[model samples]
Target: MHPLRSATAAPSRRALACALSLALFPFVAAATDGMSDARTLDRVVVIGTPTQPLTFVTDTKLPRQPVPASDGADYLKTIPGFTALRNGGTNGDPVLRGMFGSRLNLLSNDGSMPGACPARMDNPLSYVAPETYDTLVVVKGPQTVLWGPGASAGTVRFQRETPRFDAPGLRVQGSLLGGSFVRNDQLLDATAGNATGYARLTANRSESGDYRDGHGDRVPTAWKKWNTDLALGWTPDADTLVEVSAGIGDGQARYAGRGMDGAQFKRESLGLRFEKAFHGALRKVQASLYRNDADHVMDNYTLRDPNPMGPMPMPMASNVDRTTDGGRIAAEWGWGDVVLTTGIDAQRSRHRTRNAMGRDAYKTVAWSPDATLRNTGVFAEGTWTLDAGRRWVAGLRSDRARATDQRATRSAMGMGGMAMPNPTLGLTRSETLPAGFVRFEHDIAGSGFGWYAGVGHTARMPDYWELISPNMGPMGTVNAFAGVRPEKTTQLDIGGQYRGKRMDAWVSAYAGRIDDFILFRYPTGGMMGATSMASNVDARIHGAEAGVDLRLAADWSVGGSLAWAWGANTTAGTPLPQMTPLEGRLTAGWDNGHWSAGALLRVVARQDRVAVGQGNVVGRDLGPSAGFATLALNAGYRLSERLQLAAGMDNLFDRAYAEHLNLAGSADFGYPAMPVRINEPGRNLWLKLNFTL
Candidate 1:
């Protein structure tokens, strides 16, 4: 894992002096038992690697569940401060800090992979599987520029590592899952390698049937998908690694809430990366390139029967496709008490669309021209150790991004209407953004105390798709996304950590204000009934997270974590849309020589404050929602040095509840008393077997 440079540029010398002194002030202020020996060591975990950015320290690698993840976002929800927008049973969109779409930089193996559908049915994450990757990283908040720009909420990355062997070796891993509601999944991950190079392949398939609510009522959510990837690597020395990889995936899904369904999601990806460490001068140098393409199709006839209340009330179909490609290169140098890293990155994408009232009309409407988006950036970060117990980190970055609406003409047709072309709305725009940050850390070693404080800022351009496509009407008229401004944010982060053999604790907090925060508001002024359009608005956000681990005894352990966030629009004088609510998790476990068992309890606090209309990325705001809690149990046993077995149950009590940030309730899911909430699964059980050599 690697640390991402902060976005804030620099701190005042006076402020820096104060930050420097206070970093170590706590150690000198107190004298107590068991404190002096514990506070001296720096134990920060490396964050994201260049290829896969957003990562969490806590992981579910050891947890129990069926069905492999299909994308990076799906895997992220296992961590805190994360949620999803459920369309049906699967392929739910990921949300962070109550933000979705372009707000989070979603990257895989060092590249940007945007979905192809104008409606985003094949989001980049739809092609990822966490179990197939060796590592996952997440960074919350607009923390840095190592992974590209416009990551105001943060960055989420999933990556696979190249394998090397001194001798010929082969590895194979597979899993089978089954549970209630006919949920089933299959996964195969295998690799073969020798001293000079290696090859690997991975594939996954999953499907689930409709589920029932607590009241034994049937819900329409259901889904299925498949993905496969292949890779080859070359290694000339122990310190050098190079790899090339390619992958393809496709799937279909049924949605109970929308008029259309995901009929096709085709994905293609290519990537190359190399790393080398210099023995004496600089620490390490790494470079990488990646390209990803998605071709998606949505139709009402493919996934299910047409609904009487749907837009057309008859068999209607429309298709939208878009593709994004991106790459980044970076190097890190370490000398004496200092480490510096520098990098460059770029990305480009385009989109096109066509629609018809019926299947036969598809060929009658020509495809719309593609919309183009491109960006390039440079960044550098350095860390210096002022003394054995004090450290400072500084970083800076700049980017140039441009977007073009390539449609030769736009058409203003009503929903379920014939294609009519309109030529008055088309344009291009460009912007430059810069960001930086500085932080200081101190350890009261031997005192069981340590603390750090940092300030950062980020400037983000509008996402190409968000700025050009989402606002367009089904009839392709009225240009809802014609003019939009970039967004900028400045924030302060501070935290402390405490450790003991029997107890460990940590707390972190952040406060920030955003300028021209890009937002979507329902515009009813247009001739089109109601359409969402992007606009720049001022907003503020702040939050804190805290956790503690305690050893009840030599064989028993207990831990819990809590987080809360508050957001609001100063201009609108209302709460920001889609903000997550207070949540908490608690776990109790017992581990011995060969076996381990554990149980987890999760609780979500109800939310009453809402933007009135601002809701999920694709759904509406239903106001506030009631909170619920669920429990899970897990156990693992080591069969031998080379083998292990594990099993677990989710939603142990079979509680039927929904999250606050949900998609619109569909015929499949009973309409909610409030807004945007879907029924959760009942009790689910799964088991796994592992082998290593």
Candidate 2:
């Protein structure tokens, strides 16, 4: 049997049903052995701190109360101004402040992992197992130009911290999870090291069956996944280090909103890094190189029988793959109150695909290259402290981006199976993009308040999906690439944070004007089912997010947050499509020495202002969505200094609700003939056990 399949396959029901009983046996055994010890037990906290204005950082290894996340997107949704484009129970695409796609620069340990599917069946986050990483960092908006280019929305990084050992030692941490719908998960991280070197391993597996919605209707959201990674590091001294890492993973999922399911999601990755600290003006230097590959398979028969009367009448499958290689090197200098950082980075990626009519036939066919993309960038950022309470920060960057079209013929969707001439065949488009930002920050003396304001400008070259996937082009061109222009955005952001003895609060606001915004238009009912046209237009966007946390007592606390976003298509004279609705979250928690409890109430307002058939590459507005609210409850207990247990119930009321930015459930999933929002999961229960040694 294949290793990937064996790793992800479901264990016998008898074994799964006995998981809890088996887990308690170990707990009881450990408790009896530790009864004579007098060590103080550490309290387990279920809820993490609320996000501040411009940045959010948290320990990914911590156990979250409302059931641990299955993927990066599920975890990111817990932060402010972040939402997921739900398709099913897992692998949803994440949107930040109404922005989607490449606008959000997502990275794993500073490496890029681009998905293979043109429709984004395997988004970058889908491959990320958040709990396997040590830290998750988010930089909101284009307030900084350090990570990469064209990050108009934000940047998200999943990072693993290096371990430093003074003497020979071994460390281990792991978790086990069980829940409704036959959900099961396991994670393990282990490290062995001496003062000179170390070796680390991380592995995880997750699986679930189809879950019933609020009305007892089964949703086709079943999935199975597994991943394993290893790293070796050498430390010659305390201030210098070198490391190498490799990883492989695979998964399969059933989608409730699409015609086809993800039959396979295969991944491979490799990376090398070096860091050194100097005593001179060049205080520190760092360099890293990485490569990632994604091989995805989508089919109509692998997970479910083909619907003879539906759009796809027979067994069919498409295999798409992408390989990306990138690296970055940077040096930092500091003198007194001034600091500067400079770096140069480069990336190259190629995409290819093959399709066949019979099951697994695509594997026998030769893969045809569709597109190749390349980018090289240089950037510099500086910070100067004007006084003890004031500081100024600024940055500038330039990138050379190029894309080559390798297709011999265009997709024959609206053309009735007749291959049409490829307008961009054997052609390459190149663009130079420039981005910069400036900001000023002030700390109110003895007031526990800090304020910051910044302005930024970014010019972004069109991405592969926006340039090549549309069925039709703008009014005058033969294809999207010939007519779609670079996108330019200028924005101003301001925010303030206050920390008091009993309360902490933060609020941020932004306004931006965009020139040559790439917009997609879908004509209703085409011979191809749905055909999209890509065009450019002028636009405006503005939004704000605020959050506050208050400590009612030493053991009790309450927190709430609000996020609202608005945008307009100035040229089209209509509201922008797929905008996130006004949303708020209220949470209260009580934590004692060894136990914790929490409740969360989430409320979202109706979004009526929408462009019906217009949106970004992932999804479009499914008419106006109604507002809804859901509640969740969680609790935790510390069994011992090295063991802890947590449990939670999501959707406490089991109310039926759907998100505004959603894909209509496909008829293959028993949805109505006409498109409609896919309902979210109903009440669910889960329990998790964490152990460290």
Cα-based lDDT for every prediction: 0.67, 0.84
TM-score, per-candidate, Cα-based? 0.86, 0.95
Q: 322-357, model 1: which lDDT tens digit per residue?
A: 666777778888889998889998888877777777
lDDT of 1 at 106: 83
CA RMSD of all predictions? 13.0, 3.1
- Tell me the tens digit of each residue's lDDT in model 2 across 185-283: 889999999999999999999887777788878788888999999999999899998999999999999888888889899999999999999998899
Position 479, candidate 2: lDDT: 91
Candidate with the greatest lDDT versus the true structure: 2
Estimate the overall C-alpha local distance difference test score of candidate 1.
0.67
Q: Show where candidate 1 strays beyond 4 Å.
A: 1-55, 58-61, 64-70, 360-366, 409-426, 470-480, 523-530, 667-676
